[model samples]
Structure formats: C-alpha cells, structure tokens
Target: MAKSERDHQKVEAAKAVVYIYINHLAYHISPETAVLYFYQLMWDRLTPECLPVRDALTVVIEDEQFKEEQGLQFINRSYYSICNPWHLDNKKRPYLKQIIDRLDREPETESINRTTQALREQWMNFSKGEYGDCLRRQMHLGGHEIFREEDREFRNVLADYLPDYFYLYRSVTRTPDIEQLEQEHSHPEYSGTATKQINRLRESYDAVYEYRNLRQQGVTGIDHPSRLELAEFEKGLDFYYPGRNDSFKSKARTICHKKRRYEKYASYRPQVKEYLMESVELFPARTKSKLTESIDRALVRFDDRTSMDPITSKSLFLGLLDSVLLPVPNTSNILRLERCVGDVGPMNFTGMLLSLVLACPMIRFRLEKKLGYLYRKFEGKSLEGIQWVVDLFEHINLALVMNARKIGYFSLTEPLPDAA
Candidate 1:
C-alpha cells in the first residue's frame, strides 16, 4: 500500500479504537468519566511519532460534530453524580480549615499536639483535590455559580468566627451551668440589668430575634446544642455581649434553632415551577389539558394515597416534567418522557407535545417565547440545527467505530479496566 493510504488506514484505526473505548467506558463507568479516560489514554498511548493518529483523535473528540452526537452540548442528566462528591468535599474543607487554624492558634500542649497531628492528616486528604473533576464538569452543567456562592458563604462564616474557637472548645470540654445562667437572668435583683443587656443585643442584631423566638419555643442550653449552633452562639456572645464568659455565651447560642446553611436547594422549586409554566403556556388550552391528563396518569403509578393530594401530585408532575425537559445530572428520569410517548401509557399526547417543541423548528417559535433563555444560550440557533449537528457526529462516531473494528485495532468484546 502507498504511504498515503497506509496513513489514512492508521487514522481510521485510531478513530475506531477511541469510539470503542468511549462507548465501553460510558457503559461501565460514566460519560464524563469515559471522556476523561479517553483523553488520558490518548496522551499515554499515542506518542509524538504517531502525529496523524493523535491529531485525528483530537479532532474527532473536540469537533463540534462529535460533541453534539454524544449529547455533550447540553448538560447530561447524570452530571450531578459528578457534582455530589465535590459538593460534599467543598462542605468539609471549611470545617477542616477551621480545625487546623484553631489548633495552630492553641498552645502546643500534649492534647493540642495530638489533635493537630490528626487534623494535619485530614487536611492532606482534603488538599488532594478529590472533587477537582466535578468542579471541571460544572462548566458544562450551568448553575455552578450557586455552588460557588455557597462555598464562599461557608468560608466567610468560618472567617467571622475564627476567634470564637476558644469558647467553642471550652464549651465542649466544660459543660456550661445552664440552670445557673438562666437563674442569673431571672433573678429579681439582676433581672432588670440582664433584660436591658438582652434587649440592647436584640435591637442590635436580627439573629437575636430569631434566637429569642427559638428560646420561647422551648430550646435551651440544657437540651445540648449542635456543634455549629454552639459555635454561632459563642461567637455572638463574644462579639455582642463580652461581659458574659465563654461558658455563658455557649449556653446562649444553644437557645435558638439552628439556621439553615444553604438556600439554593430551597429555591429550586420556584425556578422549576417557572420553567414548567412557561413551557405549558406555549401550548393551547386543549394541549394543556392533555399535558395535565398525562401527568395525572403518571401519578397513578405512585401510591394512591400520596397521589391523591393535589399539591403532591402537582409537584410530582412538575418534577417529572422538569426531569424530562431539563434533566439534571445524577437525577433519575425513569419516565423517559423525552424519548417516546408510546412507551409511557396515556403520556403520548404530552410526550408528543414535548418532542415537537424540542425537535420541531416551527413549534419552537412558540417555545422560544417562553424559553428564550435556552435559545439565547445557543446564540438563537434553532434546535433543529443543533439536532442535525448531533446526528452528524453520531454518524461519524459510529462509522469510525465500525472501521476500527474491521481493521482489528481494538476489541469491542473486551474493554480495558476503568482508569478511575
């Protein structure tokens, strides 16, 4: 064979190898994982000598055609699996830093030394960037700003309470005299003085009102505060009511309900509801009724008791719709309403509506009126064009896979072990 033909054959073989590897890895591992694995394999196996194959593989993977075909353009519903570990790791980092900073500030006593050593080991693990891949995955998923905001809040809270660790540690080791502290405030002679101080503090900070409410609702230091709650109370006392010793402040902090940490999850309902309403509005009244009927039918599959509540049914129906329309990574879309209406009983009409809006350009004009944000992100291009691009990539990827298999470059029957 001529050198040109041989080079072409080599490139074809490499493309096939990548196709087989990507599909196999995606099945056993995950799509994101598979992509990373493919990148690593190419870098490791292909040397500078095989520039043709290397360039071909890079072009095939990076090409817009390939990406759209693999559903890489829109966020994968399974992408949340990638984010969850990172979210957990991100949550732990602040606490670990707090511990490390606290230990560093303390005198090097035997107990402090032991704690410091243990914390250092934990800090090492945290520094390993275990969630680094998840952080990278978020670029494609959108809404990453929410996670970043929460992380910032976590760090800010830690920074604000750095000095209160001393009190926090004392609270854990030496239990506060809850009854004595309460009595001091309640005593007739000291009552006026304590009440004046409490009122001043309450007036100064809104958190005090929340604390007082919790106290009125029966929360007390004797009930044993969580570490976080105890920390907040100690910090408040140290900053706002310094006359009270660390122990007293610790007891005070336990007097309120713990504040929630993050509000992003809480906001999901309104956001999803807004999108569902917008999508529904694009349809006529008759179509809207059909959509509702489909949701009601799907609800029947769940427990009748739970499905009977209109609110629950509505939320579930919206959740199902959201799952189909804007499926988040790591969530279950068992209904698969996005695929075909015939598969899900009585859901055909709703399914057909979704399919038309998502796939048909003419109908998308109506959809764009409600879902302009989606279009804006894609630079006002029609979904049909995007689908076409994806289809083109799928064809190329499959052809490459077939050519590689025919050339006997890689075995589809036996996949390599997971790199992860």
Candidate 2:
C-alpha cells in the first residue's frame, strides 16, 4: 500500500504535468513553434513540488540559451541527447561570441509536424504488423518438415513471438462479463452508444490490419511521405520533472485558441483532423468527480441489489481510460520497447541520474548491477532457456548504448567504439 501510494502520487504528478504542457500550446504556441514550446510545457510541470524536474529543465533551457550564444543549433529527430550544429573546433571560433550561449545547448528540433509524421509512420508500421521483419534473426520454421515432435515443445514460444493485434480491444466487440463489469456501464440505454463505439473500434482494427496486410504482400496502403516530414519522435526524459524532455506533457487540458486548429499531421491528409478527433479524447477523471455527488444517491437502490462497493470499484472503473490505450498493437509496443531498451540502459541509469538531479528521496537505483542481480534471482529457472532470454536483454542494452551515442545523450569517446 505504501509503495502503491507513492506510485499513485507519481502518476498524478505526471498527469498534472502533461495537462499543463498540452494546454499551454493549445493556448499560446503556434503550430510551427509548438514543438519548441513543448520544452516550456515540460518546464511548467517541473514546479517547486517536482524540484528535480524543475532543476533539470532550468539547466537544459540554460544550455539551450548557452548554445544559441555560440553558433551551434540543435539537431532534430536524434535521440539520447541534443546534438549541436557547430563542430568541436568551432568552439574555438571567437567570432560566435554574441550567441556563445547556444554552444553545447540542448536542442529542440523535435517540432510538432515532425512528431505527427513519426507517429503516423510508427502507426502505419504497427498497423501493417511488421514485427518479424526487423527481428535480429528472421527464421521460417512453419513447415511440417521442421514440425517434428521435438519442435512442438517450442510451439508456445513461437506463438508468443507471433503478434496478436485486434483493430479494436476486446472491450467493445466482445461481450463483457456482466457480473464483473460496472452496473451503470452495463446499462441498456447506453448499449446503443456502446455498439457504435465498438463498431468504430472494429472498423479501425480491420481497416488498418487488412490494409497493412495488402501493403506487406505488395499492395500499397498509402503513398509514403517525403523527406520534409513532420515533427520527429524524441525520448529520454529529464529528471527535473517527469516531463522536462517530453514534447507534450500536458495534453489533457488543451485549450484551442485558434479558430482553425488542426490535428498533428493534418497537412498530409486533409481528413486527418477528423480522424484524430474521432480517435482521441482525454480520459474522464473530472467527469467521475462531478458525477460522484448525486450518482451515489441515484444508484443506491441499484447498488443494494448489485452489492457494489464504490471505494474498491471506482479506481478499477477509471483505470480503463487512464491507461495508455495505444493506437498500435502490444506487439508493436513491445517491439518498440525492446528497440528503446536496446538504446537505453535499463531504467536504473535514468533513475540514478534523476535522483542525483532531483534530490527528492530514496529510489532503488541499480542498472549497473541489474544484469548480474536479475540473472541470480531467476537462476532456478531453466539455465539454458533463461540465459538465452538474458542474452536478448543484454543485446538490447548494448543497442541502447549505441542509440545514446547516436543521439548525443552520452559521449562515446573511448570504451564503446572499436569494442570487440
């Protein structure tokens, strides 16, 4: 419960931060500069309460100012760290004295358009179910020749590797276990709305999946974008606040000031704005709060019959919306996470750094030693089997280090490169 409380607090803080970020841009920032303003959105979340986040944002913003003072501009779309426009020797150029502040400063190249483009690309890739194509090893063992009795043992693992994506989650299309679902949620009048929502979900799943299937099998789903795409994807968070490095930390309470504002990638497809609005909406935390006052009074008669407990029930009810309900499949998310992990050290490294910067409290930081520790903990499992899995994880870490270097998060001056 104690740990859960801490986690709850963290989630709340992070959510609040996200709300502020999105809302800010919705009000003041232009679509063109929205990407740059994303940094400021992150800063808004890093208040006195979130000191580490605050401090990190301050330093990062300062670095940006410092770099502009020099002659270096930040590169966009790179992960790990801010890459500068100036060369190492360019630091020696005395002529760039006026904007020397920009030298080695953090870059904000991940503009809004770039973000949408990358998201669209990822979604397309995900929709197409392109999981196995990028596997470190792509094996085809789907023949009776290789399906001997011994190979049957590997069937479960093979199935696990196979991606299972539904255009819609089982929530809408599949009938709910009425006994397990909320009473109001299962009401008759709302069934019409639920049916429509379910249809939408199903349509989304089939449209994306079938389209991708055709595309993969030599049918083009849609024409690909050009070099000058929208805002690029960025990751690796600052410690000062949970969202200091996040592009749109506070997206929930977005207030649109523009009369003709569009979705992230609307320019590419004119209909994209409608798709986004239909697809996305903030989860209902405020709705539940407002409904609470009289909802209990009205529902009391039903509750006695249903024997419902509000305290234990509300959180679970709200959790469905609160979760990161991705447009992509779990296979895609897992693959992305694997790819991301390949680029990032296990979260242990980030946690330690955040602690160093934030000075907030104690956290169990151990990425450096995580490899050995996790191995030992799971030792009783099959040695050969577990070792293989561990090896996969290690490979991912190595990849993460590589990504870090590419994005300029950490310098790979000595030990990493030329390593045998």
Candidate 3:
C-alpha cells in the first residue's frame, strides 16, 4: 500500500475500533450514557485522527439529513436507540431487555461475552444501511474484505481485536472478566500490536482522569471582566457560594453594574438593546432578535433587581446560560461557535457571558453542570472542531484563578503549606 493508503488504513481501523466501542456501550448501557462517555472520552483527548471518527459516531446517534422528519414528527431514525429500551422489540434478540435488566440487577461478569456478541453483530450489520454515504461505503468495504475470510480465521482475528473493542468498554459498562478476556484474546501472532494499542488506550484514560481531577478542583473560581468588557469590575465578594443567597446575589451585583461586555466587541449590540447576539449563521434572522431580547431582559433583571428572589435569579441565570452555551439545538451550532468566536474573541462573547453568571454565586455553581450538559449533548464531536469551546473553558479556568486569589482561597505570592 502507498503511504496515503497506509494512513487511511490506520484511520479506518481506529474508527472501526471506536465505533464498536461506542455501540457496545450503547447496547450495554443506555444510549444517552453511552454517548456521554464518548463525549467525555474525546472531549479532552482528541487526536488528529479522531475527528472524522467523532463525526461518524455522531451520525449513528442522530443523522441531521433527516432533520425535518425527526424534528417535526419525533422519529427515532438514529442507529443508536435514544428510546426507552423496554419499548423496543424484545422478542427478536432481547438485547434491549437484557440491557435494561442489567441496570436494575446486580453487576455481572458477562461484559466480555456481551461485548463479543455486540462486536460480531455490529460487524455483520456494517454495510450501507441507514447510515451516511461515507460510513456506508467504508462499512461495505470493511465487511466485504473481513467477511470473505474463512469463518474460523475471521473469529480468531476478531477475538484478537477484543482488547481494542473493550478499550472503552471497561469505562462505560460494569465489571468485565478481564482475566478471561486477556487469556482468550491473547494471540501470539498479533500480541505486539494488541499490546501497543492497549498501552496507548490506558495512557489516554489516565490523561483524561488527571485533566478531570484538575478541572473539578478549579471549577469554582471567579473571573475578572476586562476593563473594556466591564467599566469598573470589583474582585471577589463571596462569589463561590454553592447555593441561593440573597446576600450573595446582592454582593454579586455590586461587583459589576455597568456591564459593557457586549458593547466593545459587537457594535450591533448597542443597536439591538444590548442583548447577547448568537452567530447570524447559526441563528436565523427571525429568531436572532427574539433570542437576544430574551437574554437582554434576563440580564437586565439579574443586574437591576435590588432584592431578587432565588427562584427569579435561578430562572434568569439558566435562561442566560442556555442562550450563551446552546443557542440552537443543532450540533452545527457548536461548529458555528468556533467560527463566530473568530469575529469577536472568546473573552468578548463566551467569556463575557460566563463572567456575568460568575457574579451570582448560586448560578456560578451551575456552570459546571451546564458545561457538562453541553459536553454530553454534543458528544463525539471532534475536539479540533470545538477548539473555541475548549479555549473558552481555559478562559474560565483563568477567571477561577483570579477568583481564588481575590477570595484569599490561595495566594500565588505565598509558599505552599506542608502536607504534614
């Protein structure tokens, strides 16, 4: 094979492994949680080769080509079942029933057996089914070549790749019979390649774990708005409180009053009653004005109220956060956000909106869950494509550092305390 062909082979192989892993999770666990794991896995650990695979898995979840039917009639055309598993046909294979029962019953050591079954089934069904054209073609090619092998040889080769299939399986599903799996999948001929891939997958898992641990530690910091964004910003005033407090809200409003986060970047904000405007490409002209108006009103209420109730603040903050993070329901909105950020930097758009919420400690705490929801919502999207969101996340991290400093949570100037 040529160099390009070799690279293409590698990419396709990676995609097949990832695809099997995700579908295995969907079959073993709920489809939603399965997608969640995929999102969390790739959210912080996407490589150059992971982009197209991410996009392909997304098609399995929800193909946008049939948007009109899915949106209007509430169809479930996605290969991965987002429906209640019990509602699915149980007579045929009982895959859905077994999945639902596993959730309620004790954790079993049947993961390996189930995964092998899922892998074979997915490979057999891997053709030009209801999936996208590119995926269909790739599936047809892989199936044609692989299925042509003698049954015994095919089974042995698939078993060799069991470790690859269970790469993500261990994380999402219950405990598996690891010892048996290792013994069964151990092929002296392909051991070298299998060992290399297993090591790589473990390293990736460790990296993600460390990143998440750091994220959890730092998710509770305050962010300072730039002078251009805010006329005069005050530092922390009990900004890390986890729940609703009228006093906290009052103190928060005092931190920044004349909010100018929207003005300096998008001149159109001043023209449109100072609302947070989503990308024109993402939100249509008809709906854009309405969105901005809703956000603007919420911010005004949040800022101007002297004695805002917890209920009102909660609703207002959630409205603002949703508008900023998930302007539209489409996955393309995320891609559009990256493009939109180019026009106005992250600090101006996403960073600015986040800063507004950071003022309210109650709402500030909700940021973690909201962002997690975004991650799960657009699970399987390539990190490279969503670099802007990642950048905004880093921006939030910086703000948290500042918040920590202002609140005397820690001092950069002082030495660390001994762990004794």
Clashes of each: 4, 38, 1
Q: By TM-score, how accurate is candidate 3? A: 0.31
Per-residue CA lDDT of model 3 for 1-420, tens digit only, reads: 798676555544554555465555555765445545543432222223446555543332233322332211111122222212222322212333232222222222232443333322332232222222212111111121232442213232222222222122222121122223334756422222223323433333343334334545785343332211221122121222222264322344543343343323133223323323422324545445555665666555444423344454456556666665555646676665555465555544543454446544455434544443444443345554555555555444434433332222223444422211
Give Cα-based local distance difference scores for all models: 0.32, 0.28, 0.37
Per-residue lDDT tens digits of candidate 1, residues 94-134? 32233223222323223233323332333232223322222
Between candidates 1 and 2, the TM-score winner:
1
Best by TM-score: 3
Candidate 2, residue 327: the lDDT equals: 16
Query: Considering only N, C-alpha and C atoms within 3 Å, which residue pairs clash in candidate 3?
Result: 221-400
Sort every candidate by lDDT, greatest first.
3, 1, 2
Ten consecutive residues with minimal summed lDDT in candidate 2?
71-80
Candidate 2 Cα misplacement greater than 4 A, ranges: 1-18, 26-28, 40-420
Instruction: Assess candidate 2 and give its TM-score to the true structure.
Output: 0.17
Best by lDDT: 3
lDDT of 3: 0.37
TM-score result, candidate 1: 0.18
